[model samples]
Target: MHRPAPTHAKHCCSLPSPCKECFLVSFARGGSWRPPPCPLAMGNTKWADAGQASAIAGRRRERLIPRSGPPVRSECLDGKRGETGSPHQLEGKTMKAVMYTNRRADRILQFTSDFPDVDWAVVWSPEEFENGVADADLVVLSNRICTPELGAALARGRTDRLRWVHFSSAGIERGVNMGLPRDIPVTTSARAKAPVCAEHAMMLLLASSRRIWEIRENQQRHYWARNELNFTMRSIEGQTLVLVGLGGIGAEVARKAKSFDMRVVAVTRGAAPTPDVDDTVPRRRMCEAFADADAVIVATASDPSSFRLIGSDAFAAMKETAYFINIARGEIVGESALISALRAGQIAGAALDVAEDEPLDPKSPLWDMENVIITPHVSAAGSTNDYFRLRALFAENLNRFRAGRPLDNLYHFDDGRALPATN
Candidate 1:
């Protein structure tokens, strides 16, 4: 018998749980933390040993921060189809869905090879969409859909066939502003992001320890004059690490950060304990956490409350030698403030993979700084499979939707521009 749908307020996911599922949410939360509105905690993991994790200096730990926001509405199995018009209220302009547009070359290759059966368009410009987007079956918008015109195109395609979109990256900052169609299911590239980001965070931490970048500069200037070492090089074996944002990518960064024997502390919405996270703290106390950290890695997803989460004040509070690494969104930190922190030597340095204005201009002053290392939003992505993998995950979710099975990565009901569920 079909059990009466439980009230949305009592549980997370705002619905009954799915069984025999490959995509799962697993964690301990005293039974109050249900899976909905995205995760507040990841699976709990034990701290790593400094003795076994060779050549590492810091201890490993993790934590969480309670986040507050309006509780999103939930729906039943077959809610009414969303209205066919621009979701203009969310963006204050029209939003439109577009086609495949991942930046990574490998993901492009793998996605095409895997989805040979699905007929999809790979349009590069809006001008090429002459027939108008409403007629298209599906628009596989990659990460590049952060523009106002693309928003208009998305606004134009407010009908059937615009059911799903596989975002190119895991950050979801672009998605928060996309005004996703209410009925369409938007999924993230989170699964594909974890490992690559973990590796990058670890690399920055290790590089800082070995003095690789500064050593290179001395060599380039041919300054071979002998002198006593001025600064002490630290080890990862017994120091502390505080990771901001404990989602898929953040968790992976934590696991690897632990492998280096560093303590892992994390901040997330709704105070709850999860595997690998130590001490649950509030966002206000983040600077205090940083003051004691040897390395700080931020891998948070972009949400309404997260814009400009870090600024110069936080940097000023950090130890002068501490290294700050951001593999998350760029706007999360103030660029002007970052420059001030680095130039005044308030903090040792920063290793950034993303910037406020991405593909940072060649004329930007960040290029001239000796203490900062900037990569063109390349650290968190590693393979072409992130796209193919996301597409396949979406395909599986599509199958579930068709079978009247529960959906995975269901965009929490908020303001979105979606089509009727496409099974």
Candidate 2:
């Protein structure tokens, strides 16, 4: 009494657009049959048969954004999709993505080349993002633009179609504070700017070690400072350099440090012995690592646990002639303790590319200190290569998303909140 489903050959329909929806075709003996009016024409997206089996078993598509749960630091969330979740529904439809960046349009245009099928909306502010984000299936932006208000709006379902978020920065901690949804996957451009960041750290170390700033000042004054310069100028050949973090940047710093023939001792959370480092000190023994160091560099990722990780005790344990370099986040080093150390000669000097607050306060004593060197956090600049690399990464992730494959650079949160990037 039940009739079997019939398959029609060369099916045709009078729908307005080519939609990825199932069709019921009744075929006669000769394979000539009428294609039923597509139910998709009525705007009902619930598919019946063909779309059900599209989700692959191993491809987990859980949200990477955090939910409105009790204030929990967002962890790397990954889970398999349910039986009904199918990317096939998005195949024929114009997959729209909203990209927020202060970067140029040509770079964004390359994304269009990679995904010709997708419609991208370029925005620069949260207001712009909110305007067109309602229809977006994906959001690509810098970590700085991901404000808490924007995140809250997304969590409240302001954009039901959003599937993923990509940050154009290596620092995932900034994005973590945005309270992104737990179900949406968030990715960063990890390792993209490592080479440049490492170069900057080395530059700071070398400048501070050889008293380059002092030499330059003496030259400007037309004063012969050979005697004074020789007094403070130290040779890096046999000195011990302590690197606080062993992430991409820190690893590069280690490599460059070895080229100078300096002994490298890394302080990290159980980092494996890297090629350039001669010794390893666990984070538990950070103060111990600083004891005899000629220079200590902080390149760790910024997180709750990392805030003020280096303070009075760590500075007090260092040799009086030791130099402190921070190319990482500013808050990682205790500002007050560092100021005290610099004033009291607890350490020789300090080089900071980042500070407790950006554009350091005018009244701060660090500005006038002869031993301190401060640069406006521009360590990641001077490289167009990083931009191209990020473009390629974004394209790859886009393709992977469409193909139902897992993404790369999955930033997993740990109990420490600030997990070492080496992991």
Candidate 3:
């Protein structure tokens, strides 16, 4: 059954100029009001009851009108509303959005209920997604449930109704590789995840610099080796740190690194000086900058051109005592080259939060290396704070989408990267 229109005056017409005859206004003005005749009343002019009239009225209001003008008198289901030629507005019809998520269904429903005009469907599995996406006007995708096959299906199965695709995570390289429809606008939650991921990178850098694994080994043996480790222990203070790809994550890392008195040099396409970076070098001269760094971090996006961007030559360019850390996608660094660099002691040590292939081959030599620290890609794992940030970002974007405004963190299909945040 259709839901009833709101009875309160404030909940009546949201348009700029509401019709004077709208019954909701009469209710507020303490004037006598009667149910209007609905076309759906069994082909009769009169409704069966007040409840039936309300249901019909609610359905009519669900058909969204243009934002700029007064409400127009038009048929609800006949598609005869005023045309604004705006991609954002869905004239004369309600929008249906299908979201694939692992979040609790009740929570999603409660949040979506605020917008009665939108029909929201939340699915938990790939099978449900295949069935639910058929008539959807918008799709909210979770990274955990996304795959190349599903991406291809989405691209192929897209209808004229499909307008936008949103990712709940920072990384969209995998989504880009999924062959999503290029014409539809795509966005991500990268801005929300940057600070947490940067903190994780700093943790890895500090642990690697102090040789935490060796300290743990001594503790396990019940031995005191303070003097033995002291000579080798290093501080990040006054060391030069180089960052590749100064996007959201990179910028955050640079800002935090400066707090430790580290000199930050960033390699980016832009020539403008960044806030936290002490020096900026073009991508072509990144190797020259690497030669002077005491540590290097990979925080760039992964694309075809950037695949294996830090290979043997790049590693060989770093100082022998310099540490290497990869908090970004593993494919951005050649795994074999990194392994070789570690084995030959070309660099002091390395830390990895992501791998080229996750669940990283149990037999891989990196597992046994004394100098290497490997985490199972849990850098952005603060559930409590992350949930709120992701929700706020999506909600803001949804509002912008309805208002015909440009979205934040828009993913570029041509480059397989998000538009860098202007602020």
Question: Against the true structure, what is each candidate's TM-score?
Answer: 0.68, 0.73, 0.75
Off by over 4 Å in 3: 1-89, 102-117, 420-423
Ranking by TM-score: 3, 2, 1
TM-score winner: 3
TM-score of 3: 0.75
Per-residue lDDT tens digits of candidate 2, residues 216-319?
89999999999898888988899999999887678779988999999999998765678889999888899999997999999888888788999999999999
Residue range 286-350, candidate 3, lDDT tens digits: 89999999999999888886889899999999999999999989999999999999999999999
Clash pairs of candidate 3?
none
Better of 1 and 2 by lDDT: 2
Stretches > 4 Å off in candidate 1 = 1-98, 102-106, 109-113, 127-132, 135-137, 221-231, 271-274, 384-388, 413-423
What's the lDDT for residue 394 in model 2?
58
lDDT, residue 290, model 3: 95
Better candidate by TM-score, 2 or 3: 3
Top lDDT model: 3
